[model samples]
Target: MSFLSSNPRLTQNEGLAPAYNSQSEQPFAKPPVAIESYIQDLIEQRYQEQPEASVVCAWDGDFTYRQLNNLARSLVALLSAQGVAPEVFVPIYFEKSRWTVIAILGILHA
Candidate 1:
């Protein structure tokens, strides 16, 4: 089957992500996760479920969920040490790369 047939949410939502379902074993299955849910929580869940899965593939390198989580956590610690407050906007300027992905996750998690 084509990707659309295998993952109907793409067609159903017109490119929006499918709701995360905790009870479903399949990664793509529909669940009741709110669209406004914290991005960190989603990443943590994905990290827990598939630590070795690739979360980023950039010109520099491919980074797995485990690496992404670890790097993001490190950034979080650094931000905390620097007294970065929660909900504060942390602007990131970079050409898209693996580090950019890590920065975004780090800022979201910080």
Candidate 2:
């Protein structure tokens, strides 16, 4: 999905930023699982916990967790329609940006 079409609330700056810090030590509710499983669960958990929270802050705009989840789901559907499957090498070549994050999530979910 195009950035503009997927997230209409995206605005210039507005002092948006991720609510959490990656470098900070965080506690988990449960013991750690495998990387793949953890990532999938984490994505869903974030969406559930705070759908409107900013997950990606790009030059164009900040993407909320809900928007990211929706965009990723849309990409997953597109990939499935194109016969994409597990272990398939889906090369996503985009400059470091929000779309890249969405693509990665799509590939993983697909």
Candidate 3:
């Protein structure tokens, strides 16, 4: 048995992530999730599920899940105030650091 499948033939399907799903299963079985709910879940998971988990460890500093989620939520508020919505693209430009990770999640949550 292979890591991806019991059949070694799966090796031939490299570069395709969809190969992991068996053909017996529907391609889109799960129902669509609302953007608000998805963002809320992401924030809640980071803040509530594992608040102490370190999400970013930069040379200058570090941030825990709670901090990142809080920053993300704040970004969400700012974006919402600016009338940003789903399907909208937010530009991200930041140097690699703890703040960068927080900014990425913040933009994503927004």
Provide backbone clash counts, one per model. Answer: 1, 0, 0
> By lDDT, is 2 or 3 better?
2
* Model 3: residues with Cα > 4 Å off, grouped in runs: 1-43
Q: Which portions of model 1 miss their true places by more than 4 Å?
A: 1-36
**Any idea what lDDT model 3 has?**
0.72
How does model 3 score by TM-score?
Answer: 0.56
lDDT of 1 by residue, 24-92 (tens): 337555666668667788889999999999989988899999999999999999987887768787888
Task: Report the C-alpha displacement of residue 105, candidate 3, in angstroms.
Answer: 1.0
lDDT of 3 at 20: 55
What's the ranking of the predictions by lDDT, best on top? 1, 2, 3
On residues 1-110, what C-alpha lDDT tens digit does candidate 2 reach at each position?
Answer: 57657777755432345543321234463566657555867978989999999999988677899999999999999999999999888987878877888899989999
Candidate 2, residue 75: how far the Cα is off, in Å: 0.4
Q: List the residue pairs that clash in candidate 2.
A: none
* 2 or 3, greater by TM-score: 2
How far is each candidate from the true structure, as Cα RMSD in Å? 9.2, 14.4, 7.3
